[model samples]
Target chain A: ELKVEQNPLFLSMQEGKNYTIYCNYSTTSDRLYWYRQDPGKSLESLFVLLSNGAVKQEGRLMASLDTKARLSTLHITAAVHDLSATYFCAVEMGTASKLTFGTGTRLQVTL
Target chain B: DAGVTQSPTHLIKTRGQQVTLRCSPKSGHDTVSWYQQALGQGPQFIFQYYEEEERQRGNFPDRFSGHQFPNYSSELNVNALLLGDSALYLCASSLYGDYGYTFGSGTRLTVV
Candidate 1:
């Protein structure tokens, strides 16, 4: 069984501060993805890291993957209230593309 | 372009009842996947359908089944529902061999 775990399941930070959410998986996989979900909403894709050293950035968010370590990270830079949401990291299981997701990091950014 | 589409944004069912959820893949997408997200938790894969066949499945039990149409649309059926079955069911679509996926807003199922 593949297990994905995220750290700091709940985070509360002030605006302009920075934080990083860590995702560690139990198995080996080359494809990792970041997704953000607001309360009661669907997930929004943030990044797709396909290689061991792959990194992707979008506005105030950035994500990186390290396949050898079976770990991935999502970094929030200078957080804003709008950035408050639950973030999840998913690893593609096999050729079928099944995703095993982390528990998720709920970020609450306040002013 | 429209992303993944799921019908009946919300539903309420009683224990032991059966429920069916539907999904339509996005344009040019040939594969459909279903996931179940419990409150305060991440989505868990249920299964994936491609070419009108179930190609992959997760740990869900046999009570959970699905069907895919030739047009790439899909349906998820959960029989003898339990209270724990209540959750937001999500549908995702992607092209075959493509790692990218587009998720649907999800159907919130509340089992009483």
Candidate 2:
């Protein structure tokens, strides 16, 4: 069974601070995805890291993947109040279309 | 162009009853995937449909079944629903062999 674990399941940060949410998988995967979900809303795709050492950034969010280490990271740079939401990292096992997701990290950015 | 869309934004069902949910994938997407997400948890893969057939399924039981239409739309049927079945049913669409997916708003199913 492929299992995904995320660290700091709950995060409360001040504005202008930085934090990184880590996702670790038990098995090898070829793709990793980051999504953001607000209360009562659907998920919004944040980043898709397809290869080892692949990094993608948009605005204040950046995501990186390391296949060898079976890990991915979503880094929040200079977080702002509007960045508060639940962040999830999902891993796609080799040749499988399904994704195994981590427990998710709820980020509460305070002003 | 619209992203993935699901029907019956919210539903309420009784235990032992059956329910059907619908989904329309994003334009030009040939694959549709279903996921179950409980409150405060990450979504769990239920199944995936492609080419009007069930190509992949997750750890769900037989009570959870689905069908894909020729137009790439899909329906998810749950029979003999249990209280545990109460959750948000999310439909995601992606092109075959693609690495990214677009998700729908999801149907909030409440089983009484």
Candidate 3:
């Protein structure tokens, strides 16, 4: 079975600080996705990283995939309260893209 | 456009009972996948349906089943529910061969 793990399951950051959430997987698929979910809400797609060295950015968030290392990272820049939420990284199993997700990192940005 | 939508936003059922959750795929989507999200956990893939056929399934038991209609909508049925089965059930939709998925808000099931 494929296992995905994320570090620092809980994070508390002050405004203007940057942090990175790392997702390490046990397999070799290059397809990865990042999603954000607020408490009691559904997941919102953040980025779809499809290949090694693939990087995507939107506003204060950026994501990258390093398939060769079986790793992916979600980087938060200049943290703000509005950006606080749980972030998940999912890796596609095989070419079919059936995602196996990590435990997630709950981020709380405060002033 | 309106995204993927799931019905019965919340439900409560007694153990040993059965429950059905419905999902309508996003406009122009041709595949539907169901996932189970326990409290504070990432969504786990349950199954995927395409062309009215079940194409893939996860490690779940047979008691968890699903069906897809010609319209690409889907239903997830859980029988003989256990307390562990109570969670947020999410339905994700996408085009065939498309890696990106649109997820629904999910149905919260509580077993009493």
Candidate 4:
């Protein structure tokens, strides 16, 4: 069984600050993904990390994976209020398989 | 192109009743997967369908069932619903063997 864990389940940060969310899995999996969801809304895809040492960034958010360590990280640079939302990390053992999702990190960026 | 779409956005059902939800996959995708998301929690995989057959399933019980049409549309049926079953049901679609997915807004089922 693959268990995914995320740190800082709740976050409150000032705008323009930097932070990072960590995702660790209990099993081996090369494919990892990041998703963001607003209150009462569907999830929005953020990044797909396919291999070890893979890193992807969009705007102020950056995500990276380390298959060897079975860990992934989502980094936020200069956070803004619009970036506030619950973020999740999912890991898959195969290309075509179900994903095990993390507990989720709720972020609140205030002015 | 249009994204994945789910019908009956919100539903309220009594315990022990049965409920069905529907989903339409995105264009050019042939696989559909269903997930259950509770309040303040990440989505949990329920099952996946491909070639009109169930390809994978999670830890859900038999009371949870599904079907996929040739057109790749899907339906999720739950029997003997319990209040614990109440949650947002999300449908995700992707090409066969691909990792990228397009997710529907989801159907919020409330079991009273």
Candidate 5:
């Protein structure tokens, strides 16, 4: 079975601080996805990393994938209260259309 | 354009009852996938549908069944509901063989 694990399941940070969330998978996968979910809301796509060493950045968030290490990272820069949410990483194996998601990291940014 | 859309934002059902949930994929998407997300956990894949047929399924039991229409919309039906079945049912849409997908808000199903 493919297992995806995330580090720092819960994070409480002050505004302007920086943090990185890690996602490690047990098996090989073709793609990795980063998503953010607010309480009582559905997931919103953050980044899609398609290859080893692929990195994508949007505003205050950046994501990187290391397929050889079977790992991915979501780095938050200059965090703000609005950036507080539960972040998840998903792995897609081979040609399968389904995704296996990580346990998620709940981030709280206090002013 | 709208992303994926699911009906009955929330539902409440009792044990042994059956329930059906609906989904409409994003425009131009031909594949629909269903997932179950328990409280405080990530979503778990239940199945995927393409070309009006099941393309992939997860470790779920036969009680979990689904259908895809010609229009690419889909429905998920669960029989003999159990307390453990309570979770948020999410629907995702993508083009066939595509690497990315768009997800719906999900239906929050509560089992009593």
Candidate 6:
């Protein structure tokens, strides 16, 4: 069984601060994905890290994957209130694209 | 191009009843996957369908079943529902063998 764990289940940070959410999985998988979900909304794809040392960045967010360590990270740079949401990291084990998701990190950015 | 589409934004059901949720894959996408998300938790994979067949499933019980039409639309059926079944049901679509996915807004199901 593949188990995905994430830390800092809840976070309350002031605007302009920075933080990193960690996702650790128990299996070896090369495809890892990041998603963000707001209250009452579906997930929004953040990044798709397909290889070791893979890193992708969008405004205010950067995600990286280390396949050898079976770990992924979502870094928040200079947070804003609009950035508040629950972020999840998922591991895809096979070609089927079935995703085993982490517990999720809920971030709340305040002024 | 339209993204994934799911029907019945919300539903209410009693224990032991059955519910069916629908989904239409995104344009040019040939795979569909279903997920159940509890409040404040990450979404759990229910199953994935490709080429009109269920290609993979998660750890969900047999009470949860699904089907995909030739047009790439899908339906998720849950029998003998329980209060614990209440959650948001999300549908995601992707191209076969492609890692990129697009998710639907999800159907909120409340089991009483």
Q: Score the docking of each candidate (DockQ).
A: 0.81, 0.72, 0.75, 0.86, 0.78, 0.80
Say which candidate scores most in DockQ: 4
Would you give the TM-score of chain B in model 1? Answer: 0.98
Question: Each prediction's TM-score against the native?
Answer: 0.98, 0.98, 0.98, 0.99, 0.98, 0.98
Candidate 6 Cα misplacement greater than 4 A, ranges: none
Q: Per-residue error at A27 for model 6, in Å?
A: 1.0
Pick out the ten consecutive residues of candidate 2 chain A with the lowest summed lDDT. A92-101
Interface CA RMSD of each prediction in angstroms? 0.9, 1.4, 1.2, 0.8, 1.1, 0.9
- Give, for candidate 6 chain B, the lowest lDDT window spanning 10 residues: B93-102
Candidate 6 structure quality by residue, lDDT tens digits, A1-101: 99999998999999999999999999898689999999999999999898999999999999999888888999999999999999999998877578889
On lDDT, the stronger of 2 and 3 is 2
- The residue-level lDDT of candidate 5 at A103 comes to 96
Interface RMSD of 5: 1.1
Candidate 1 residue spans exceeding 4 A from truth? none
TM-score of chain B of 6: 0.98
- Write down the DockQ of candidate 2: 0.72
> What's the C-alpha lDDT at position A28 in model 1?
86
Q: Candidate 3: misplaced stretches above 4 Å?
A: none
In the range B1-112, model 3's lDDT, one tens digit per residue, is: 8899999999999999999999999999999999999999999999999999999999999999999998889999999999999999999998887678999999999999
Error of 3 at A8 (Å): 1.2
For every candidate, C-alpha RMSD to the true structure in Å: 0.9, 1.0, 0.9, 0.7, 0.8, 0.9
Model 4: per-residue lDDT, tens digit, A38-103? 998998999999989999999999999988888899999999999999999998888778888999
lDDT of 3 by residue, A21-94 (tens): 99999978768989999998899999988888999999999998888899898899999899999999998865
Model 5 B-chain TM: 0.99
